[model samples]
Every structure is written in C-alpha cells, then in structure tokens.
Target: MIFKAIFSGFGGQGVLMMGTSLAHGAMSNGYHVTFLPSYGAEIRGGTANCTVAIADEEIASPVASEPDYLVVMNAPSLFSFQNKVAAKGVIFLNSSIISERSSRSDVQAYAVPCGDIAQDLGNTRVANIIMMGAFIKKSGIVTPDIYLKSLESIMGGRKKGVAEINRKAFAAGFDYVKD
Candidate 1:
C-alpha cells in the first residue's frame, strides 16, 4: 500500500517534525519513504508543510498534491491544504486552533486537540508527539513505539529536557483514544 500524508501548520507547531518522524519510522519498518518539506521565508512565524510518503514499492512522486492523510496543526494549515486530500483520505486537525470543524464531506476528518492534551500533561511543547501518537493510531502507518523511537532520534539529547516530556505526551495522546 502507498500511504501519503501531509503535515501543515505554523512553523513552530512541529508539522515538519511529524513528517520527519513518520518518515523515519516507515524507513525503520523497511518501507521506501520520502519526506518533502515546504516552507516560506517567514519561517517560525510563517506557514510550513511537509509531505511524507511510504510505499511497499519504489515511490513515485515526492510531491503530494493529493494526500491520503493530512495532519493540520492550525487554522491556516487547515484552510491551506484541506482541499488537497484524496476522496477517501482523512484529515486530522489540532482542534485547539480549529474549533468550527471542517465541512468537507468527501473525506473523513478528525479533530484532536493535541496541544491542549500536551498542556494537560504538563508540557505544551510536546504537542507534536501528541499529534503523532493520535496519527499512528488513526493511520496505522507505524506503531507508537516505533514512532517514539523515531521521535527520540529527532529530539536527540541536546534539546534540553524534551525527550521525556515528549514520551509522556505521546503516551497520553495514545491513551486518549482508548479511554
């Protein structure tokens, strides 16, 4: 199966991080993976998006004009790429920023307040991991453990006390669906 996903939001929202972690997880699973990131000149305060595709066979294009899954972290992220999803695709929104709900009827949309969830867990910055946890369960691209490993690699050891909080945040988000 070819799985294409897009992560979009303001730069600090960790959209690109989600794509990178997902790509690494898929690569660890021995699947062909491609990660493409798009950013504007404004950077951190500007728009950013990344496309991650995992396939059993050699992947085709890295550009995902129509993605199977979308992880949006902000209102602009939703408005910018909501129409880019495929007919049967799913859009996962960070409900903390988007409350009105998407009106697209052709695709399945889910609103997860990952930022709020992370804050409730005592770390507002681990929102990305929270979103990833929810995404893995919803998309089935990789297990939460693999995703956590990928996240560990991405966070590395230099980013202060991030890894532990991120792990906790991911666990919280993962458990949210079950509880």
Candidate 2:
C-alpha cells in the first residue's frame, strides 16, 4: 500500500514538523517514507508546506503532484493546494482560522478547529499536533500508539511538560474525529 500526503500552512504553524512526524511514524511502522519540505523566503509568516510519501516498498520520488491526503492549517493553504488533491482523497482543514470549505466535491473534507483546540489546551504551538492526531485517526496510516511513540522519540530532550501537553493535544484531536 502507498500513501502520499501534503501538509501546508504558514511558516510558524509547524507544517514541516507535522510532515516530519508523520514520516517518522510511518518509518517506525516499517514503511518506506520520504519527506520534502518547502517554504517561502520569510520564515515566520511566510507559506510553508511539505510532502510525505509512505509505501511498503521503495518510493521513486518525494514530490507529490496529487496527494492522497492534504492537511491545510490555514485558508490560504486550502486555496493553494485544494486542487492538487487526488479524487476521493481526504482533506483535513483547520476550521478555527479557515472560514471557507473546500470547493471540490470529489474528495472528503474534514473541518478541525486545530487553533481553537490548541488554544483550549493552553498551547497554540501544538495546533499542528492537534491536526496530526485527527489526520492519523482518519487515515489510519499508523496506530496512535506508534505515532505517539515516534513523536516522543523525536521530541526527546525538550523542556519539561512538553510531552504532557503534546499528549493532551494529540488526544483532543484524535477524539475530535468520529469513527
């Protein structure tokens, strides 16, 4: 099985980190994965995005012109990448800051209030993690336990309380989406 995903948002929204985490989780799950990150000139507010490809076998390339999944953390990201999603693909959007919905009808779109959820969790920086939780739940690319373990491993050596808040944020997002 093969899965390709694109994560996009403003530079400071942790878009690349989200893709990196997903790639790491998939790799730990024994999948061949590739992560490609891109950003505008400005670091903080400029546009940022990444593509992650996961498969059971070797992947030929990292670029995804049309991905099976797309996660947009902002309205501009939605507008920028919505058309690039493959038909019947899945889209996870941040509804807290994005007022509009995807115009495409060929794909499934999920509205997640990542910003509001993160704010409620007392850490706006974890908005990406919140989105990642929801995406992992819906996609089922990797088990939650495996994903969390990979996340903890990647985030090791951070300040205290970081893992706890991230766990809460991930759970909040995972619970937000229904089966």
Please give, for residues 13-66, the per-residue lDDT of candidate 2 as tens digits: 998989988999999999999999884466567789999999999999999988
TM-score list, all predictions: 0.93, 0.97
Task: Work out candidate 1's RMSD over C-alphas.
Answer: 1.7
Record all residue pairs in model 1 with backbone atoms less than 3 Å apart, i.e. clashing.
none
Off by over 4 Å in 2: 39-43
For candidate 1, the 10 contiguous residues with the lowest summed lDDT are 170-179
Query: lDDT per prediction?
Result: 0.85, 0.93
lDDT of 1 at 151: 78
Instruction: Please give, for residues 91-110, the per-residue lDDT of candidate 1 as tens digits.
Output: 98889878766778999887
Q: For this target, which candidate reaches the highest TM-score against the unseen true structure?
A: 2
